[model samples]
Target chain A: MSEPVVDTTHEEGETRLSTGGLGRTLLVAAGVVFWGWLLLRWANDWLGGLFVPVGQPFVAPATIESLGASIPGLAGAFDALAFAVEYLPALSEGLWLTLVLTVLGIFFGFFIAVPLSVARVYGNLSKYVSLLYTELLRGTPLLAQLFVLYFGLNISGYVPGFLDGVFANNAAWAALVGFILNSAAYQSEYIRSALQSVDTGQLTAGRAIGLSKVDAIRYVVLPQGLRFAIPGWTNELIYLIKYSSLAAFITVPELFKRANDIASSNFRYTAMFTITAVLYLALVITASRMMNYVEDRTAIPGLGTGSGR
Target chain B: MSDNEHTYLLEVDRVSQSYGTEKVLRDISFEMDRGDVTVLVGPSGSGKSTMLRCVNRLTEIDSGNIYLDGERITGPDVDVNELRKEVGMVFQDFNLFAHLTARQNIMLGPRRVLGLDKEEAGKRADEHLEMVGLTPQADSYPGELSGGQQQRVGIARALAMEPKLMLFDEPTSALDPELIGEVLEVMRDLADRGMTMLVVTHEMSFAREVASEMLFLDGGKIVERGPPEQLFDRPEEDRTASFLRRITEMHS
Candidate 1:
């Protein structure tokens, strides 16, 4: 009976205890965390300041009537947001300015990036120049750069009226100045590394066919270099959106500034700021999708598919 | 054929090259006649590739004159691009533009350097692609093809310019064992058609079978130069004999 009871059904192998168990656990854990966060947000809104001992210093959040009433800081935010919304055209006009700034910044940054990349790679000039240029831009903060343009020109009385009038008045122009410098510094490295990745033999091959230095760059080297750089360049595009928020400080009304202005004008601080958060979410999500589309379009299939860099 | 007897197609007189402080080629001198497949055979670091690069002025020779068809290819005054068009090159890696198809790869040189119209370039590309037996693969990118096919595309790309000479720096060196024969066969076909070629390769069989004159380069200098039979089967110098012996022993 013992001999006949011997089992040979151990063929499923070890480590086959079901990986879905771990996945399901992780899924439940994530669901719990997400709902916990949503619950906290909901409880905070429905009941005033969730941690009040009574209706003493902080507003009582447990009462639904108190939740509808505007609290002090939020009351001002609500009023500011309401005022901001009634005049939609003014805020939308700022989009034109933002667009102008983005375009000009990209254009000028391209000019700066191309030459700097080439210089860093092949220029007979000292390492000091490249070092100096990179350090000078990166060492100084962008906000400081905007201030320097504004105040340096103002204090010295050295600026032409037309120049000051255009840049100082237009938040867009000042933003462009700051954005271009920032973009140029970073782009130089991205593009330089890309150019360097191209085999030295490509230059030799071009030379073997008799391409001039300019022609080699224009034809052989630049195309390959730029192809490798596309993904990094897409990253730079996304970064431009977030970093662009700083331009609002100089007075160019991009999405963030408009959102802030809306929240401040409305007494419904929670609702308005939530809408602002959603607007930012939408912008970033769209940018991410667009970048992915571009990457798929431009990348070399096998190499790019793996997301190596 | 005496070395001094004929007018040379390209001549390197006392040419030397070095990177930074280390010298690669020291006092190297050689000459090639028109329509000759002059094979340079040696172990790695012989600087044969560097020597070939100097002819096209692909690499600048530190101190010497490289006369290509009697014109100094190394000078600043001579249009370097013009020199390149006259002398095409095939790399070991077969550096075809990956974004482009085989036909596009071949056509690029003629279209860009020669200023040939798209039609003329296309015609020449087809002719060269046919010559390399890659007409069927003309529309395919370099990435899609096998190593052997890529090399054929490289050969076709080089030939498309209709250059006076083609420099092949280890064309078959990077190929898989099975793929080497197809590339060598293409080289042999090119030799049969009488292309003036300077081939830096280790394929002794290709050299023995196809070369008109074979130069045994060791340590950046030509140790011996003669017909393949004279060099391979009945070698003269100690180094050449030893090199040939090593090759034969390895094969066996």
Candidate 2:
């Protein structure tokens, strides 16, 4: 027998490791300084372009008053805020495209991951196959995978015409497929580990109650495994959101791609890139919060006890 | 029925088991009639628990035949899951599903394996929980309950299956000394109600009061077997006498 188990509630206080608030505040300040320096360096050309027509060198302004004269609306109480708001409408289409792609990619990937993970952990014949699939997908980079499906298969004429008509016409579809395959590889690992973490005694209890092995896994093992997997799955979800920007390499016209086009044309690289960065940050934080809420809701008290400690 | 005829609810014939080169049981055999409560007493490392586990096929025997309700239970053709439905087991550890409530734990076998409707299973869970005197704790999870309550929930969980035979592998061993009686009290009541039970336990007093027969096992074989009073008062074997004396003195 193992050492006698100590009660979980008593150990919780000593076990918790606080994430210091001061460290996070300092990191935030560092990010602000970096972005501010980029903005000041590029402000002259960027502000000049908004006033003058194309192909013209508008006068550079040394003072706020002269800069305000360049654009009519810049004379407002908050010029920077006003400027960011004005340019926001142009990015909406690309932002919407990125959001849809991420949602569908993650949804389909998670759907595939559940069965693949079960097969890997439990199935006799399918276990080896699932193992190879996960290894091949996870071993390579997501960007390379996207390129293979988008350019190698579609543009190089390997894909049949009808299939190409469906997946090749849009870079977004190919990127979605890449995200699905990549995320499934990563998610399946998280799921398999979670399934293994559940106590073996639970399976014995299930079988003793006359449940067949499959039924035992379905009713007893899976619900607990899913709860345990939530924290890891949330990480995969956030990574998928960030990696969606890689779709821009294939001309998907996602948020990052639109930012690139807007910045290059307007000569306002700092402002456009900073806005896109903030939007991505917002998406990541919101997703993390939503998943945390789900983790709390599904947490079974006194179950999987002593694990956190 | 003829005078010579007796219905054997369970038969363990020439049962032998081994782990690697270590022989755990050697040519062990026993027969249990309906409504028999046979308590197996042995020192640690003896094959008492192994024999209990073999009855339900939890531990596969290397060479043996086990018959349950006169049907061959050890053969390849046996549906082990179906066989398990008729042979309920309670572990040394309570082994209740930690996440589920006591009521849910009891209800699971009936609902999932017996194919009882939810309402029917729910009602059966209530009856079984009451049988184990744990009706008040039905809504509590196993983790929240004390060792005794958890073990009772385990008993209720097995009873909800309504099995023909119940195997208890040191059911009270994991419990605290004070908590042992409540579990034993429930077992005594079960015996009174004619549940055929095979129990591996060191609770000799309970065995003396409730057991129809007693088997003293040592070195992976039955050293002595007979009625509890005969084994307790006038053991034929010197090893059995000393072992009984040692345990009795320890208890006193």
Candidate 3:
């Protein structure tokens, strides 16, 4: 005589269960197959070499020696792994140079951006002036700016002789200045958005507690704003790392320039270029991880979390 | 009107404010002594909150004078930051800094503005936390707190400033009905300690229980003002009587 019971509570879960597990498994399998295809295609030569029988002459040693002697400086297609191993020392020197430039560019750029953003947000006269500066820098290409600083200004005698005496004729100095100013314009925008994202009531709260406007901004507003800007700042930092390659045009002898030198000299363009690209990937990944750690530590619960970039 | 050369703790004379063409407060005048609690009761859009905001100069008066402890705060020469230190204000929305914990919120004013050392600021913060019975929640962020607890922390933050006069602008208006009692209780304790206070609120029961003087404001002017008992039991104006009747009926 008991009425049949229905379990409507479990129906939604059952429907989701039908699609979720199969979808996830298919996605994972597709990812694996895609990466497998990439590895097989890119590493075909190395994998084929590995399958070659040991002590079996694929090519006569005398023939290779004769070729090397006859051509003087000619080499056939490069083994990327072998090229990477042999020239690791030279590549590392250039990598260090790239790291140094990136560090200086981002450090100085961030410091400059802090004041620029503050001026735009809180200053009367400076806000418009900062806006103009930002527009000018952002509107032009970084390459053109570098050219203007290094070739145009350096040669035109527009810059003071004394200033040139301090920083003149140095491609590294020109590249650093160009990169810093360029990144500062971008970083300032990120920081400005962060400052605006902070609740206006926070400023009011600070003032209500008797803090002068400047003190409030310094102690209360900036701390929250800077934390909010971390993700965007890190993105800019990675961009700076990749952009450091452009310094080669000005003869900064950075990672890309060194790789180019080695590649041209050895005629191993594919190997050297691929290795250099991987190095940049490593640098960007390390920097992103470090900043993520910082973001986690400084995160104020419920305030800056879940804010969209 | 009793002018014997003694200054009240707060004095607002003919203060008026307008936005564009709309006058929010007009000729709002009131005075309170060192240990008086004056409650301003009015319907929504009646300029009660604006009047309280004017007292702390959170909103500037268009044409009037506001004196705190006999010092004219309305003068252009007066340092608004310095005046803010002596006059504490609690907002309607419990504007505690979301990034700061309750203790840090209380300590910021004393440390940064008052130049108190960290230890002294921390000590004062705890004292205020205890005053509001929020000592256990001192480390909680505003986002983690209930509405009532957050408002209590707001009060503690103001009290830590040790202002000469306190202003409460609808401090409990944003809280849920069940949570309103806790905030009102903390305020009642402050009134009992003879703190000079000006409050804008719709809690007629709290006003009747705690206010030494009650003001009924309509439009931009005070319609009636007297002791809470006299104003509630025997209104001098028909508008005041009807407003109170409407509020009581709505609450009941």
- Of the true interface contacts, what fraction does each candidate have? 0.38, 0.49, 0.56
Report every candidate's CA lDDT.
0.71, 0.80, 0.80
Candidate 2 CA-lDDT value: 0.80
Model 2, position A199, has a per-residue lDDT of 85
Candidate 3 wrong stretches, greater than 4 Å: A1-78, A155-169, A306-309, B1-4
Q: In candidate 1, residue B161 scores what lDDT?
A: 82
Off by over 4 Å in 2: A1-77, A155-169, A304-309, B1-4
lDDT tens per residue, model 1, B154-228:
888888888899999999878888778888888888888889999988788888888889888888788999999
Candidate 1 stretches greater than 4 Å from native: A1-100, A126-131, A154-169, A267-270, A301-309, B1-6
DockQ of each: 0.25, 0.42, 0.35
Model 2 chain A is weakest, by summed lDDT over 10 consecutive residues, at A1-10
Q: Positional deviation of A28 in candidate 2, in angstroms? A: 18
Give the per-residue lDDT digits (tens) of candidate 2, residues B1-252: 112566589888889999999999999888899999999998999999889888877789999898887778997788889989998899888888866888998998999999999999999999998888877777877776778888888988998999999999899888889888889888999999999999998888988999999999999999999999999999999999999999988976
Q: After superposition, how far is residue A55 of candidate 2 from its true place, in Å?
A: 25
For residues A27-104, could you state the per-residue lDDT of candidate 3 as single tens digits? 457556544533343344335544333222334444555555555445442333334545554566567668878898
User: How many steric overlaps does candidate 3 have?
Assistant: 0
Candidate 3, after superposition: displacement of residue B64 in Å? Answer: 1.1
On the 0 to 100 scale, the lDDT of residue B25 in model 3 is 87
Give the distance in Å from residue B178's predicted Cα in candidate 3 to where it truly belongs.
2.0
**Per-prediction TM-score:** 0.78, 0.82, 0.82
Query: How far in Å is the alpha carbon of A303 misplaced in model 3?
Result: 1.5
